[model samples]
Target: MPLSHNPNLLQPRVPILNWIADMGSDISDEIRYRLCATLASSTLPALLGSLNSFCITLLAYARLQNTILLYIALCDLIFGVMRVCATNVSWLRTVAADLVVVSGIGWATMMAATMVVVGFSDDTPMLIIVVASGLGSCAGIIARNYAAPRLALAQVIVIDASFKIPFCIHHPEFIPLILLQGAGFIGVAIWIMRQQRETTVRAIAGQIESRTQSLQDPLTGLLNRRGFAEKAQSMRQTSSTKALLYLDLDGFKQVNDRFGHGVGDEILRQAARRLSICLPNASICRMGGDEFIVLADCHSRQEAAVIGARIIQTISLPTVTSAGQASVGVSIGISLFDPMEVDLERAMVEADEALYRAKRAGRGCALLHDPAMSGASKAMA
Candidate 1:
């Protein structure tokens, strides 16, 4: 069955055309978004400079009796004005993507039409300069919208055909030059498209990596305290019953002193891995040093205790590092949330108090937060 009709394949059966179309769409969206974003940003000075150049050109061409040049310049001037006005309108900003494509096509068409008319005109110097400027503009557009391969191709084809079609019909002697120019534009567009794709992909990947680094712990590759807090807050808002488990690894300082910080870091990584395995649904965070936090959904204090117990057992297992085998136990304090009272700060304090109680009672145990534990927690502290 044809890929287009299959309802299974995402694209049409023709591989080459499908690939090109997909690439073009991706590039167009990226370039359009970037362009719109740039225009929206504080690049007004640069924009004004570009508009000034166009205005100057318009004034210079107005002296000539060429109606086509005047018309193109006037259209360009109006487009520039609209772009400046668009910055303030919410509706215009929303439709900026479509406007960009339409305006690009319009400008390309006008420039092409101007080139065609100028080639047959009596003003030799003006014709030469206009053709040269048109080619330069094509190059500039290609560079500016490098990510949008289809837009680049369309602009090039329009401009190239404008120059070639009229010259071929009127002069016929410049056929060789026209074919050469056409082939050159095609080659350059393909090359620019490939380069732009690579550049964009790398930029996106770098952004993802940077964002991930900001939120993740360097040692364990687990979410850091800030990341955990943000995620837990969101989860609390959505879920009725949730529990926050505070865990501190026992004898971590001893291991760090005896085996060096390398082994200590490995232990933290292994502990994070274990916690993730034991409580897969929980948001696990390395809350600095030997402390870790887990925010999870629970039906009652009992369910939270069960999860806490699992985490304790998993973390207590001996971790084999390059230096040697190291053992550490975890004391967990679980704070169960009442659906009516969703105070994160109070729950955290309760959990911390419970953790102190667990440490006082024994090293390797899980304790659910209780009001009476507060006095005991103060004494231990």
Candidate 2:
């Protein structure tokens, strides 16, 4: 019979679509937030400059009208691009050459409206006003780009409101369109921010399960070989004294041979439980079969030896068996790290050698090795 499909068979995960949606949302929020800040910061100077230019342009000769309007148009376009790039691309790049031409146009327009250039006339009060206004607008733009966007945007809104009275009196037709555009941009930014928050939450949650699985041993709930290796390497780097003990259950093969494989598995499980209990802080790992490794941060070589001896003593105790009573002993080899010889792989090898010595000495013994001195050789003999 065909096996029935179970929806629960598939482990729960954050759907890819949801993750993508969230990422998009977060990016949009960041963009909106930046845009708001930029606009707010520049608004005051922009308002002062725009109003000053608009009034001067009205008072100034028709001969200068073309240049002034061109400058204002350029300023608007330049600022629009700056806001876009700052929010959507690089958040921190304050000086953008791409915006230079537009800024130049805005400067020219502000000059045209305020100071009538009948000749090379630098002495006029109107000319001074125009230059000062242009500089203020430029300063605002720079400040907005460099600082937090929210404050900048708030300033812009205030300046824009102040300018609206004059703007309506002089050119009432443009006010409605400008307000609509600003509102639409803000709405889009809000939507994007919502998407971004959702995405980050999902991304963080999805990574948790993946990391847990990687760090955990599926069969025994101890650290897996990979996790053990990582901990050993970390300990080797930061620790002054570290010990790795390699353990192999004595007569494990005979147990597998005499009892069924299931009974042998039960014994291994029981062994793993006892080892975990004994080495609470140490990273305990099953290196497949009956071999296991424990990486411990010990105060001294004697401490490592004590831990190894305890492991052997614990595993040698009587274990409840399915068919009858069964007991097993563990042979353990421990290697303490020296400042000179602290390589992770070499430490493991020395520990393995010590374990071999313990197995040879007797099935139930523990052997400790110091790379600075002789290890287990005398005991084995």
Candidate 3:
């Protein structure tokens, strides 16, 4: 084709390509999908740009009757139609990711450069139009594909070659001036793109870090109460029945008073570690201070009781830390209910009631709350 004249090609001045590429894919499959997506982003821009090029090249060919111009027009029609149609089809984007997307960008960059090179030899009026469109195409290429610096720079080089080599040969006296202008243009574009990428990366990364911190307990490396509630919302949609375990550490305050807060903090960390070990397939959270909660798929009272006993026994052992040796016990209250039917708040209330019953029965025991028991039933651990 001649050269793209789409004004909207310049609209995407932001360094979107660099930002998308920086959000790296941890999985192998994602890399291809990301590349395909990036290619898809240029669909509208390329389509519009190609239309201008296609129309002008046809006009130029009609007037000059040049075989090269005719060939360029054909290339524009085929490349433009194929890219626009393939991208719009979802399966084609993923299935033929490497073949289509990589080749598409290759075809596009090559075609743009070819137009810039051939169009320079036209008459004065057509040359002016070609020159203007070529500059616009170069800017669009640099702005949109800045994510891949190699590709962006390669495109700029090709375009600069098309313009510089032809103009320098024709006007031997202006070669020095042309070279200076081209070099300065490329250097400035590179600097601006690098700065834009850094600023965008910092802004997005900071937001993600802040959100992650809000949902975590800094002390025990477990979910906080708010985080637990947020997690439970997803559980409510599942079909399985689950149990809520409300735990309170016994003799924690006495250990803190005797050994200072350092040893107490160590004890708390050990407690969290023990809970994770006991309930490996469960969501665990440190409620506050010595209280904690667990959500797991528990079917019956006997299974819940066995789990509670294991937890109490593990937590009761002496935990030796750098500060000192500290010993503590735990009381567990388990309530089984359908998460979808009863909800987390109501289930937690029942677990809390059962927790008080466990404390009353013995400091190191488990209790299952039932309306019929009236706080009479307890599992001595």
Candidate 4:
């Protein structure tokens, strides 16, 4: 007491020391009563969280498997009851077996108890009703995430039926309570089913939207740059050899210069449609402005050269623009990927350099990269 007369040191230790002292209290009489109160107070939120999570699970089950909506409802009621009961008594301590038993017994018992209480309210004692409901709720909470929904529901129905005969024969007045509980469970189940349907529809819609975005180009409705990269990367990784052609449209400036930007856009769209028909397996992309890239499968350098030749010939085809007949040819540079040799980006670079050579050589032809002749090209660079 003298040491604590100074407020500064005494105040700092007071709260922590009080808490520590409380933990050491003897578990008898006054201390026991306080401990029980503290435990019960803490247990309430945990119980509530369990109940909320069960409700969410029930909704998820309903949405994911619509055919088992009724089954899920019954399960939810059973597990809901088990969860409530388990708070007061730890029925399944071991993590392994506790999981299965909780779902099986807890959910089934609740449905059974509800039916008995609903049908024979007059005869069924308050103690029996409490025990059944509490045990059922605890079981549902601890059960595995996806143990058959219908089996759980069936067990509940069986239990409910078993409890009814005795109460109806001897004490008919109790029938109302049993019916009430059954009806309540059915009502909750129906609500869960409706929510499940809405969620399922929403999920399906989201998937469709995601697929559309993946396949489509955001600005052009043709396949995007991302779509091209994925296809090219996959083929290069799996196959023996392939080719990439980089094309930058020559005389595209004339369209933008004479007719303005809008006509230039229409020209690009028309170019995409016409180009897509030229090669079946090839992927084409607009790499900003008038630049485009094409990737095609090939077994040898000769096959790749043939594809590049076909592309150059196709681009030279006539198109009727606002400035009368606009014949726009492309300068194409070819780069080939070797399974044991070149990397992905290096192949594109070689193709790009070849493209610049074509442009310098009067922009209508295709140029392929040859490592043997690269020293000469390097000197020019």
lDDT (10s digit) by residue, model 3, range 261-326: 888888999899988988899999999999999999888777787888888889999899876677
Order the candidates by TM-score, highest first. 3, 1, 4, 2
**TM-score for every candidate vs. truth?**
0.63, 0.49, 0.70, 0.52
Q: Write the per-residue lDDT of candidate 2 for residues 73-155, one digit (tens) a residue.
A: 44544554443343334432333222322332344343433333422333355445544554465345334332222322333
- Model 1 lDDT at residue 312: 75
In candidate 4, residue 356 scores what lDDT? 86
TM-score of 3: 0.70
Best by lDDT: 3
Model 2, 224: alpha-carbon shift in Å? Answer: 3.1
TM-score of 1: 0.63
Q: Rate the local accuracy (lDDT) of all candidates.
A: 0.68, 0.57, 0.70, 0.55
Q: Residue-wise lDDT of candidate 4 within 1-381, one digit each (tens)?
A: 211121111111334322321322222333333322332232344345345434533543444433343454566556655544433344322221233234344444534433444334442344264346544543442232112223333443455455555565776798898789766764554445345434543555566678769866665556677777776666655656777778888888987788788777767776777678887777787777877787777787778768877776787787777666666777788877774477768877888888888888878777778788852222111
How far in Å is the alpha carbon of 182 misplaced in model 1?
A: 3.8
lDDT of model 4, residue 285:
78
Enumerate residue pairs that collide in model 1.
Answer: none
Top TM-score model: 3
lDDT of 1 by residue, 1-381 (tens): 221122212122445433322334443434434433432342254244335435534644664666666777777666555545444445554444444455555666767766676666666676676677677767766666555467667877887787678668877898898789789878977798678666875676567678789889988989997787677667654746888888999999999999999899899989988988888888888889999888888887667767877887799899999997999998888787863576777878888888988998877888887666543332222
